[model samples]
Target: MNETQSYLTEVHCLECGHSMPYRPDLDFCEACNAAWLDARYDYSRAADLWRPGLPGRHVSLWRYRALLPPVPEEFRISMGEGNTPLIRATKLQASLGHPAIFIKDERQMPTNSFKDRQGSLAISVLKQRGVTECVLASTGNAAVAYAAYAACADIKLWVFLTSLVPPEKMREVALYGAEVVKVTGTYDEAKKIAANFARRRNLHLDRGAKAIAGKESMKTLAFEIAEQLARAQGNHTPWQAPDWYIQAVSGGIGPLGVLKGFTELYEMGLTDRIPKIGVIQTSGCAPMVRAMALDREQAEPVIPQSRIVVLSTGDPGLAYTLLYRAQKENGGAMLSVTDEEAFAAMRWLARTQGISVEPATAVAFAGLRKLVAGGTIRNEETVVVNCSGHTFPVEKHIMDDQMVLDMKLSQQAKSKEQGLTEALRRLEEQITSVLVIDDNPLDRLLVKRVLQSNKPYRVFEAGSGPEGLEVAETRAPDLIILDLNMPDMDGFTVLDRLKANPDTAAIPVVVVSAKELTPNEKSRLTGKIASIWQKGAFSANTLLQHLVKTIQTGTPSTAGSDVINALQTLDRSIHKIVIVDDTPADIRRLRRFLEARRKYQIFEANSGQEGLAVIKAQRPDLIILDLSMPDMDGLEVLDTIKLEPDLRRIPIIILSGEELSAEQWQRLDDETTDILPKEEITPETLASHVDRKLS
Candidate 1:
């Protein structure tokens, strides 16, 4: 039997279920334009290929090559990418009160990330296909891994990356001899350029999530986990899957592949049931988390702004589709953690479990902590957190002097008080109270779960307006997210009651409703509500931003001075300004004017779509929009911005060539700060409007 005979039985489209022959160019489904493909095999026969006591001395992922998409023996690439340590986190478990906790430390892999697993297979597949060159866009780890593996295969690799990527990462990728191109924009922008470059040069492209070989390679993590768990439990009986599988995700290919591995194991009668997967992401770039909260099938792309570079994928390609299905099929949820929380988790893991991880990996631990604190994960269940990467060249970016000092202060306090109890107290101190008033149980749960990801909020639910008011008065919540369609006292009544009460009046209220608001209702709630969100259109990320802002601005008088100080420290003092225009001369002039101010950080976007991405990433205080633009016009952009609860607060100054009609004036007046005709505007006039709005 040759390697070709042992190859995957077939490949099928994940979307349209269309079957096709394996080829590098056949990545997406022809029938449905879907980007994800599933490499299938005769599971019964594949299972027979593996036997007990196998993988004896094999330290690499090739131990499971029988199940993976086959490459010829001579073409295979291996660098000990698998068999990562699965350490029992006993001390961390004691702190969190979980019965059993394990860390699948993938940092031990070559290239110091799980991406090495993907690269090993991806580059091998490329080698098998006789491809000599390839192009890809990466945040950091993938570029390094692919470049390193490609170098070994003697393949020419062109790597495109965002300028914001850490200098150390860029140096490392370039060191691998790959031609690295740094784009002066966001990760999504870099990806677009890379895709175009690949097309123009006719180079093989490694589409992370869309690549079957890369996706299949991730299965090794799951396989190793299952096998190790069995060994740990004496290997007497069939392996039992962990109760929860947690990992920090960007493209979500890792989780998808892990889930597929569990499914295969179940089919082979090796595992009883698949674990509930927890997808963790940084709050700054969390489309997958937002989509899951909204119960959407696809994630809407947003500009990536996460400081954790490896997890800063603005568009996760086809991973969103696979993730949506995985969440629906399994009892799991997506969650997000702030950079602060992730840094704190990194410190905590190092102190408590002796595990050092990058911010991207630390995010999973942060999510796990939140889940345990929120009672989403039971104390008795066994859990595994995939520590996917470590901080090396970017160690300085993980924690600064202030963060280290804070950690030391915390440690000193822990020594004085009950260790675990003191830590839990500190964790609880960070939580803000949120009250959700909705008649529907599902709605309440949905919002509650969404807010759970933010990790700094304790959610209190009320089924009716009266109950809501009672909870708000009793709890004196930092924020109230109200739904307007409740029977016997709608959100309007509840808002009125809450505003009338002195105790709860100061608390910010965000009204969420499925029904359209009348003009009178809008006017009535204008000053009373902090923001109005339509139920179906509400986004978790947007809601979280509002919540964070509310917490920062509306610190309770009862809160301790220490708590107040901590909240204040979380605020970013710098103001961000974004300019969206196709005209380079106009953009240049505005940038020069803005830069002269000395206090503003300016971001430029050449198109409305790019502008939207910038807004999503930076959450700029102000925006300058050109009326006429290609792809998405200024009006369309304005409409889109107005619809977002977070972006709507930003002041927009419209630049138009033609004079506006009364309708246009009214529309602009309703949504924008001011509109300036191109002929009438000067730097001084623009600065005046900007100053007033910013002030």
Candidate 2:
């Protein structure tokens, strides 16, 4: 069979069996519109009509052209999205008593999700059909994935999401440059509005299962898993399918496609038995699970609130279709899991297997646990759980909680000897002196001693704001320690005076008192006070915790083979780091390194073309550059770097290794490349320059 005849001959309604010609712009079954249509194929005229022979084809889902709808190859956008790894669960097997347990890690895909698999295909088809602008209604991963691929394809995308969507996912969608609309109601409501807008605008509606291409894209997971199983058995054993294929069914396209893939393999005589597909749903939104249990023909819509951000679907059309087809084709059933159960399952997977899964993915394992405990699933059955998202959210919350606890625990761990040692260390390190302005001498002394021991601090006594500023001007201390209560001028007055004074404006301040500051007070203090510590509420340990966090946040790590490291180090001291280089590779390497660190805030400019403009906007602390760069040379950057009065104090570290003559060395000494290097770089050398300049 020629490639032209592959993919589809027609689209047939599942309910009425009425066939219609394939159209890229078609959203649903033209006749029924009620039932989702399945793509029909002329099986007799297929090319290389064998399943096992497919290993030679492309690794993506598009490899199955015999099953997907026709779309131009040029329009297909991919980031190597398919062929995910199938991981074995040895620990889960031992505990759950399942002889063989595995997980399909979909997080490995582009955008860290399997959603890309469907998004790439859907957007590709949309582009092919001449749809320039489109709208999507999703609360979580789908929104993120769709927005990104749409951007990649240069298609205008409008995404509608409810306020219930997670803030992080919302930021992701926005970051992808998609126009986002936040609705006050549930995702279903937003979806309804999106549908109406699509109809009014004559825009294309792209659901995971709306097009054959999207659905067929998911088949890559099944084919990959099948090949993996065959390889695992040493090619001697006949390839056997999974006993239980467990996956979370929200829109249900993923699970349904798996069954379709199995049917395809069976038609090719690759397998004789179909896997028992278990449809898992969250208890808060178990429309399909409820329908299946009652043996209803269809599901009624219900707003779900357990996790409105992720599982925000009110309708379960796809889930109902899965239940109807998978249950009938293979002996299977639906299971529902509560939010609590889902969380527990997710945590278990993370702790035991080190696989951090999204709550939706966790629902599948939760269902499997229910089935196992209830003796519904046999111990011998092989189970596969599809882990949908990365475990970053759960881990972030866990880290935040631990940080809070560390502050509390450090108080218990504090000792007088440790305090004295810290005080001596601070004194030797020449950390800036701070004045404690309070009427109570005892409270002042206690805070003084705490800071002196735990941080680089010097204690100064002040009866009021006037006295504090008087000492601050005379001593020009690097920081101020203040109390809200004072005899003459309160700590707030001292803070205001210190900040108003140009000489001491940059000095950091710490508020020390027994009073609990309100949110308004904290906001008012702003840059003047680094933090507020309650007299008894914050111990030396808590101060240390704050210091460590501040330090980690303040300083960029000098690690990596990137040009941005030097600039990033400077950025921590201030707002930005500037690198003036000519080579794209040097700029790219540095930017990538700095971006990866997260600790270092770095920005770059390749030439002198807009070097000064970028510097003005970024306001960098230090500039590291090659002496020669296109449009702007090192001398030009150096001259411009020091020309601005606001940028005069900022240092320049020339990162060049070209062999220099005596004249060149003399020129470097007089100009910005004062710390010029002629050999390879090292962290210690860079650190020395940063410390010498910033300290």
Write model 2 residue lDDT over 215-273, tens digit each, in one string. 76776667667666666645643345677788887777777777787767666567666
lDDT of 1 by residue, 322-366 (tens): 778877887887899999999999999999988888888999999
Question: Would you estimate the TM-scores of all the predictions?
Answer: 0.56, 0.55
Error of 1 at 313 (Å): 1.8
| Best-fitting candidate, scored by TM-score | 1
What 10-residue stretch in candidate 2 is worst by lDDT? Answer: 400-409
lDDT of each: 0.76, 0.66
Error at 363, model 2, angstroms: 1.2
